[model samples]
Target chain A: MASNWEEFYSSHPQPANLSKNEDLLRDFTARHLNGDTRVVLVTSGGTTVPLEHNTVRFVDNFSAGTRGSASTEYFLDHGYAVVFMHRVKSLQPFSRHFTGQKFLNMLDLIETKDGTSVTVTSENIPKIADVLRKYKSALANGKLLELSFTTVYEYLWLLRSACQILAPLKEKCILYLAAAVSDFYIPPNEMSVHKIASTKPQTISLQLVPKILAPLVSLWVPNAFVVSFKLETNKDLLIDKAREALNKYKHKLVIANMLQNYRQKVTLVTQQSSYVIELTTEQSRIGEEIEMYIVKNIVDKHEEFIADRSGRS
Target chain B: MASNWEEFYSSHPQPANLSKNEDLLRDFTARHLNGDTRVVLVTSGGTTVPLEHNTVRFVDNFSAGTRGSASTEYFLDHGYAVVFMHRVKSLQPFSRHFTGQKFLNMLDLIETKDGTSVTVTSENIPKIADVLRKYKSALANGKLLELSFTTVYEYLWLLRSACQILAPLKEKCILYLAAAVSDFYIPPNEMSVHKIASTKPQTISLQLVPKILAPLVSLWVPNAFVVSFKLETNKDLLIDKAREALNKYKHKLVIANMLQNYRQKVTLVTQQSSYVIELTTEQSRIGEEIEMYIVKNIVDKHEEFIADRSGRS
Candidate 1:
């Protein structure tokens, strides 16, 4: 049975450092509310469900924070302040483009008797410069705030804290929830204190994770533009699920993606209409991101949303 | 019931790029066999068990590949050719030092009208230089071979391929199985092709993953020295579990650790002798690592094992 969101929060303890993060969130949200700029809270990456209290084993949703991280960059370019809440080690904006050995490989060492100097190889200087300039600019202007979480418990706690802190922004705030949060989790009460033994067959019972969107849309930030994502392996269930979520939650949009081609294509589903955003084979080959178009469409729609509400008032 | 290792191999299709990885492994092993250096195949990081064939969700072990990555660097220092098999995005030997924003933060952009030059800041130069020099030297000497896997299926297949390739090394080979391998897994036939519905409570049944160490010890690379790791959240269970594994697999050693303080302390368990390798509080506070001590002990023991066998022959 699905648990009550209120009861869920009450039953589960608040994650460590929730208040501390909330302080940062409040400060960031307050700073943006004073400005004419729009604010976006982009929740990225996947949430983990620990099978054991100390977490020797866990169930994880598959996400590298690609959509959310890329979308944050686009949002920043569109003149919005972004709070990037992501999994601890998942990809982040600016740095996501160059990962693994690619980062180190771009560098060269120049050693002299005086000292050693590390320089970006000439061939890779342009790309590094572009990314670095943007990264430095964002930090310099205080346009980006980063927060991280690992487990589902921590994610939910942080999300609610962010909502309360962002509540003052109301219509000016946007919640872009691209995180692949676990829909089922082993609650703390049932989790083993130690690592589960390997000697026997294991049967793991997972309870339904209470739908936080119910409370979030109605109680937390009703006037804010909220966007959710639905990922599937089977394409047939994609649109129906996306539309269902939109109708049920009365949210602004649902981005539907198939697991196989998520980076290349996604569907933007709204209450009024549904549209497809895809990268052509050549565009994909030449390194075009579907998120570029996705973010553009959403930004345009968000303007319409803000205007419509102001007209109603 | 536990499935036989041979049947398990036959049941699951080979991982993609297995043949390609095997070819690389063959070449690396052949090159090392021609040389006088001992080769250690160090498996690091955690393995995943996909809940769906399309892999929207997976069961994962808790490991950042710290022990394995750190050990690989130490093995290189010990004059051993190293095969570093790890989880795709987990920590690596050299690059592990700088992760997340730390890498970007260490860099400075020097832009003139002529062009832009990216340089490591003065404070970070010494550390980056040290790691880079070692990294370059290892690659230049062809003493390091890296292979990566994301899932348990891929790890197992690659491991067996590596064993077959390294068998010719005989007593000169060391299998340092440090990866936090999953003990239970849902069979491929039982996994969902689509994302599992989250509308209700879910019960996942996992069977015991076949013990590959049995075949690894008896059938493949029988003459090679092998070491396995056992981690428990409870310290009381640590030594017993390690000894049990040693007795069962008849492998050369088992490194036992408590998950809570693994980096600070580890116990080396062998048939006739068991000892603890620990970092003092002062050492840990000073950023000293226990892997340095662990690797030194293992390298010394490895030499003794090789000499003992040669003397008997």
Candidate 2:
């Protein structure tokens, strides 16, 4: 396992497009901070761990980024400037509302002598328009900035870079670490340069991924409200693990959930107390997402944290 | 390693949706065979090997289903009925033309007092309409059957089931195996029942997955035209490995490709000879895909194989 964050960054080469993305991010942050806008960094989707340097195959976490993508809209609605970092090809805000064959199903095609035309079906227009309006508004105001990464190494590098930029903003920044990051990864020196041959039985050894949250909480953005998610399959261990993470990282919150029922229920675990937030059957049937409630609670908690810090100063 | 295919099948449970999908496949094949139409089974995308039965994380091959999805369209245009079996959410024939945010980017949203509407931009209408027409025609003619799988076990089960239904047709059946299947997997008994906790360094032991191609060639569809893909990162081993597979399995063909330049070049290897197919920069820039050539060659070979068999009989 890599014990030092600096060493880990040095050992792994930066992603080819990191500098370009960093420049864009820097400008976005500068504009938001200058306006005295509270910025929320929402990390979405899963990070991949390549088995080979060339990466013919990799280990992936199962995340469509629904939680983070859905939450981004709520943050924007609540007047927070949003930095949306996600996995490439994973779901994104606004785009998440139209996936699979949904967009195609909603449109009608008309052919004429001149050419063909496509239009959204009459019944679906109002619904699609609402989403489009929010999406366009965010883009127009430059309140939303999108960045993407594919591999675990890229994710870590980008996360640190984001924290470095957000750090100076102090309590005005909120880091919503919702991405399902890989806990284990093959070291750079240990990974095969080429695709591993399958002619014989192979054993893959993975080292524990260093807890970057440790540095991010204690050093990078100490005053920022940091919220992390703890997803577990075993119900018995869910709250305990979330509490443990809170104690160890000394972060503001750990949203604990079981994999099977995460969509319906989640527990907000903090240093002081724990509370469950769940959706009723009726609410879920009517297409009410739990992220709305989750974001509302986080926003309230963040307000209190900021107020407490200001009073002390 | 599982040397016996039957034993391997017995050890793993069938996919939960296999029976439902098989019913659809059987009806589609039976209907097409009665019409004397040649049927091609195109397996696309990558298979996932779950580390846990609950499956929070999995080992996945690097494939966007580009080869299989692109080739499916070619096969359809050539008057062959297509069975597109792919990883869930990977890609589809018509949908491949619009992925990520491309579909949304091509549209213009209009708002009014009554509601809002979405229309394909005038410039993009002709292109979208052309694809839509092809998609609608395939459905109307019942020439396309879509089935999906996520895990390696599910893929293996569905592949065997598809072969069983296609076996009686003999020379009319084609198996285009383009899916990036995993070489190693954890057996059901060995897989964790819950999500694997990542509190410490972990060692994951994987057994060699049984070579299903052995039975698929010798037993399941002995007379069918089978074309498998060999994707390698090392240029030196690409052709040699393809040849080795051809020699061992005695399959009709092995399409060999190096990971870096796969879109531009590929070598088709047979027992008798090997030939390289390549696309120039000008051709690629004009939107020419290598799959078009690849499918054409496969179709010609399948025709020759049928002719030779008929002559012998």
State model 1's lDDT.
Answer: 0.91
Worst 10 residues of 1 chain B by lDDT: B1-10
Those runs of model 2 whose alpha carbons end farther than 4 Å from true positions after fitting are A1-3, B1-3
What local lDDT does model 1 show for residue A225?
A: 95
**TM-scores vs. true structure, each candidate:** 0.98, 0.97
* Residue pairs with backbone atoms closer than 3 Å in model 2 (clashes): none
Scored by TM-score, the top model is 1
Q: Candidate 2 at A241: error in angstroms? A: 1.0
The Cα error of candidate 2 at residue B250, in Å, is 1.7
Candidate 1 local lDDT, A195-269, one digit each (tens): 998888999999998999988999899889999999988888999999999988999899999999999889989
